[model samples]
Target: MGFRDRWVDWGNGSGFYNLRVDDVSIQVFRNGFALIILPRYENIESSDLLSHVFRDLYKAISYLYNIGIVVDLDSIKQVNQEYAFNHGYLDDVLRGRPKKARVELDRDARGLFNKLDQKAKAWIDRSYGDLEIETNDLEYARRLLLMPEIIYNLDKKLAPILEELSNQIRLHLEVEERTLSTLEKLSRYIEELRDLQRRPSLFKRILNWFRRWFG
Candidate 1:
């Protein structure tokens, strides 16, 4: 069965949703991904630069996943490390798992966790991850993601240039655009997943109160 099939109240607007990217199951509020109106709502072509970016991003994030999140030191201007995932893939991993990702000389430091010997080669139990977007980043992601037309329009406008560049400069501009888009979409997707859970509207809150009081 699909992951959403396990949702408790998927039919209601107030239920939670479970999205399984892999072994990790991200639980979100009802309709959490409903706002993720991505542009070009079609399968990304293998030749598309964005496909490469997405695949690399996923691989980087998943490499040390069993150990925990690999925090990007340069991704945010603020350096505060936040909680992300957990590591319990071994009987002793829980005892020594790093609280968060370690930083590298520059960009993503997820590589730091690659050499951890604490993890067993075999599968084990784990429950150390949380589905969250910083409270401060919600609007940043929501607003940019809501404008799917902009991305589509830009892609259309650049069709000629992209075609020319593919033969000449070899997707330099396209690669930049694809890379940025990949990061933006991932951030927004995470924020969307945490939306209703963090910022329930007044009406929803009241409804929840009623459910509790009446039940």
Candidate 2:
């Protein structure tokens, strides 16, 4: 089944509030506060999807920030129970599980900034000419890296990356079975080294004794 979605009311002339990234809905208010809600899905893996959602959210935030809007970090910083899936595979994950998932508040904002900086560097390649046209500012990228909403939104974007990383690992393991077998053979050879018989040559034995003593 697919994801079940919802959105808060967008009043008339309220300075554009609705932002949807895939199945997640980010409702922005005129006052800069925003709420991110996720759709409920059944029996679905969330690890990857969540990553992509958050990453794209960061992109969206970059878009918003460039327009000179102050991002409310406090409003969208934390992940609440409201964002979790309400039904389908997601519901099953919480069926016998706890009502809420543990969210970590401690984070490295500096690292996030570094990432934003990298993206901005790439963005310049595609926007260098446009950047010179006066509507260009990199401060938004800086704000996005520093804002809590960006981080919160980032969690959604990262889900897909995580899934892709997982799939890559799985593929590597599957395709490297022959390499694993070769390593196993090497391990066996090492294990047999201790059982190797001593040579009977007096010269070789004397050399071995010398090596053991000082070489």
Candidate 3:
């Protein structure tokens, strides 16, 4: 289901939201803080979906920085496997006698678990490898999840910062343009003065002045 359809209110404008990107499920909980879950799944598209989700998360983080809300990476974990399922599937194997169907089901469950485990590890690496953040830290994870809402409330200050930067760049460019124009005019004037010094009329005027004085 869509995120809006699954949004559940917890109270005080805090609640649960399931944000889906393509086929991936990213669960977000809002309780004066945010909690994000990257679901574990066994599918061919799972890796790509996870990568896309990380990119989206980074975009959100960058937006926060642009708005003067710097996220503390120390408060975020690189890997969190608490949501990863346990080996309850092994219990099914012991429940039935040595039948062909039971063997197939057991094998399938094992394979599914392996795939999910591998995917979860890879997602953790890709998400938090360079950040150097520890995984499974409860407090850090809490701050990381609540980042979106924290930045949202600080949104009012963003426009002024952006406008100030834009104005500074514009002023610099205008000054550079004016400086170039002034240099071009100065160079042209110098060239004209040099040409006048080389002209026959100027020499003639000097000759005439000498003749008038010596005649």
lDDT of each: 0.43, 0.49, 0.49
Candidate 3: tens digits of C-alpha lDDT, residues 49-152:
45755665676555445644456765654433432212344445544533212011121111211222222111122232121222233333344557788798
Ranking by TM-score: 3, 2, 1
lDDT of candidate 2 at residue 210, scale 0 to 100: 84
Q: Mark the 10 consecutive residues where model 3 has the least summed lDDT.
A: 101-110
How are the candidates ranked when ordered by lDDT, highest leading? Answer: 3, 2, 1
- TM-scores vs. true structure, each candidate: 0.18, 0.26, 0.33
Query: Over 4 Å off in model 3, which ranges?
Result: 1-134, 151-156, 203-215
- In candidate 1, stretches whose alpha carbon ends up further than 4 angstroms from where it belongs are 1-129, 137-139, 147-150, 167-215
How well is each residue in 157-204 modelled by candidate 1, as lDDT tens digits? 999897887767666777888999999999998887577557668548
Q: What is the per-residue lDDT of model 2 for residues 125-158, given as tens digits with 9 covering 90 to 100?
A: 1122211111012343245335788888898999
Give the backbone clash total of model 1: 0
Q: For all the candidates, what are their Cα RMSDs to the real structure?
A: 36.3, 21.0, 24.0
Taking all chains together, the TM-score of candidate 2 against the true structure is 0.26
